[model samples]
Target: MGIKEQIYNRSPLFLQHLFTTLYGYQLHRERYGPVYQERFRMLLEREHTTIDVKAEQLDRLNDFLHFCTEHSPYYRQLFASHGIRLPLTDLSELKHIPVLSKEILRTHMENIQTDIAAPIIGKTGGTTGTSLQVRYTIPDMQIRMAHLDYFKATHGVYRGMRRISFTAQDLVPERQQVDVYWRMNRAANQLLFTVKRLSPRTMAAYLEAIERFQPETIDGLPSAMIELARFAKREGIRLTCQPIAIFPTAERIDAEERQVIEEVFHGPVFDQYASSEGAPIVSECRFGQKHLHHEMGIIELDTDGEILVTSFDTHGTPLIRYRVGDRMTLSQRICSCGHPGPIIESIDGRGRAFIQKPDGQKIFEAQLASLVKHLPNSIERIQYVQMTTDSVSIYYVPDAERFSQSDERLLMERLYRLFGRDIHLDVQAVSYIDAEESGKILLVKSSLTG
Candidate 1:
């Protein structure tokens, strides 16, 4: 290991950012605490209240420009390629800026990362089944810590309250050390629950941990959260500690799933948008306003609906205009929360879809899941593939005992009700559905595309 990485691994989270000029920890007790309470109160205000969100966005953009040019070799070349100099006065032509793809960013690691006292490694989870190792400087690690603090504070789960985080790393083999370190760093107010072994029995153990720990909040991927909630509900376990919030990140939180989480937690559920390639982009307020964390970076929705992010926090690898594969709507409407950051109405998806057409009319990817949910005791895990325009293949992962002819027939009936008999139904019992490297089960993929 390099001296930089060795130093970073041993360094405390608080000191990590202190060494970085580009990074600053969000002062939760000093500044963010009062602002957080005030923002929650403002959320009670009517949506019509005008908020000056653009100014904050501009401020973030300025910071991003400075951070990129000063520290990131990738951004320096990118700007030079466009024949642009520093002190960019206008973002009007931001669409013309280069979009940083994951592939491109990976190839330029040496220039992308900063030299720190310690080395930080870059990693991708199994959600996409793509495990990537990237390196970080001590400063880069601090930026992440600061971002996490900002996100948690925004949701009122800042200090004094314990957080029980359900992480996908709990299930993976290589991430054990990271899980251990994260747990130790936040030991005073955090409990780490691994989802790697989320069988019925293990899930029961997780439930018991939550009951015993009685954390002030629950944070993890939406998929993991949903699974835990389902297991808890089935077991008749009441997680009624009245946690300040239930925070979901690392995956899309659909309306139905959000409702389920809200029902399980009996409190407000906040959705946090973050990625391996970018800083925390947006977070939802109690009023359901997804306030873009404009303080950290500049983000835009591209013409193709992909989220483009640029962060001032970039020291290791600078991302000027990075295209995050996810989809979202950039709202012009003011959030009832008085935060000056613009709101995102919804995150549509990661562009994964299963095209289904019954009578020449296209069926959305979501409709496949809808069909399965109506089936009698159908397993919630399902995937659909469109072999041809007319033929559709379905893969359903069901519990061992429940995978029977009767269950198949009931599920087919539901599909027939929606798409008629011309569509194909292929159901099977697999030991498990594969999750993306990020540990999110896609549930569906489409060969047929527009």
Candidate 2:
């Protein structure tokens, strides 16, 4: 840890809160400056426009491409090698350029980044075990934050509101003896909850803190929210605090999880699709429709449901035709929300989260989740770990009263049918399944190397 962390670990809870507030103030200054204000104003004005969005997209795409060719060495050579010139009249011509993969970005990061001064650095959550560091210009970061804040504002959440965030941020020290697993960010008017110490034992404390805080907005990993919701329901602990909105981030939430969170929090759950890699925003509207922010970037869907994004905001690290390794189904039907952007039917998270069959076929996370969906609350949580092609280990937390031997048999039978008799299924009931280092639960963890 750093010097600050060393001090924070030794200090008392009140001092830690002071440190967090000080840090939050610093971040607030960085994130919500004049540039942020300007971008936010522009976004608010553009939210309900009838102007030609397609024409504006093309114009922005040309400008961004021109900037990349002029500043970024990697894109300049790649575009030149593909015989692509600046100012492409149509978006279809972008197909000439190759799709940038995660591995390619990691290998060519130095060349890919432009020589900008004082760029903000960010790291990916590394769910696939390959974390990457990305850079963003100040203006780019401001615009991204503005877009996120604007999304929250539309959902009845605004700045200075008391918000509770359950994320992987290391706010609580491991050696702390107190029952407090949270820190107060006075500057941001936010309560930061650590997902590390969350369990049946410490859940009451978390709930008590949240009730006392009375947060207007709850945002963070959906898995953490599900844990709290499941615990609250099982313990019959009804909270009097009703948030204005619950925004799930950093993880994909299915319909069942969404319903549980909404019921527990007594608020609407609005899902969003964005990445730490500075990808454009795809936020859910009030009508439960996911709309792509056309001004932010362009999304091109592949036949296999993979998406290639060209983010206009990633000027510091230009991501043109970047394969972000997430799948989504595009909708053809118009939304009743009156947002003039394309609709995303569903976000199938992390193409890497899959099980490899003996015949080299892949069963994705969403498909694997369906196997346990009919368990009727008997299974609290489940995880699939594939170590080799022939074997898979299933770890699940089952409610003792509800989960019977027949439930285990039914789950095993379903797995056997899905894997065929060739693969080995090792299912075990456990107290809990550990989350990833980032504190986000991965439904499927594959150890096989490609």
Give the winner by lDDT: 2
Candidate 2's residue-wise lDDT over 59-85, tens digit each? 999999999998999999998898898
Q: What are the RMSDs of all candidates, in order?
A: 14.2, 12.3
Query: Where's the lowest-lDDT run of ten residues in candidate 2?
Result: 123-132
**Model 1 poorest ten-residue lDDT run:** 20-29
Return the TM-score for each candidate structure: 0.62, 0.79
Residue-by-residue lDDT tens digits, candidate 1, 167-277? 543122231233222232232355655544444545666666667777788777566567667777888878766788888766666778788777876767877776665
lDDT per model vs. reference: 0.58, 0.80
Error of 1 at 408 (Å): 38
**Alpha carbon lDDT at 59, candidate 2:** 94
Model 1 spans with C-alpha error above 4 angstroms: 1-63, 114-118, 125-131, 135-144, 171-186, 350-450
lDDT score at residue 159, model 1, on the 0-100 scale: 58
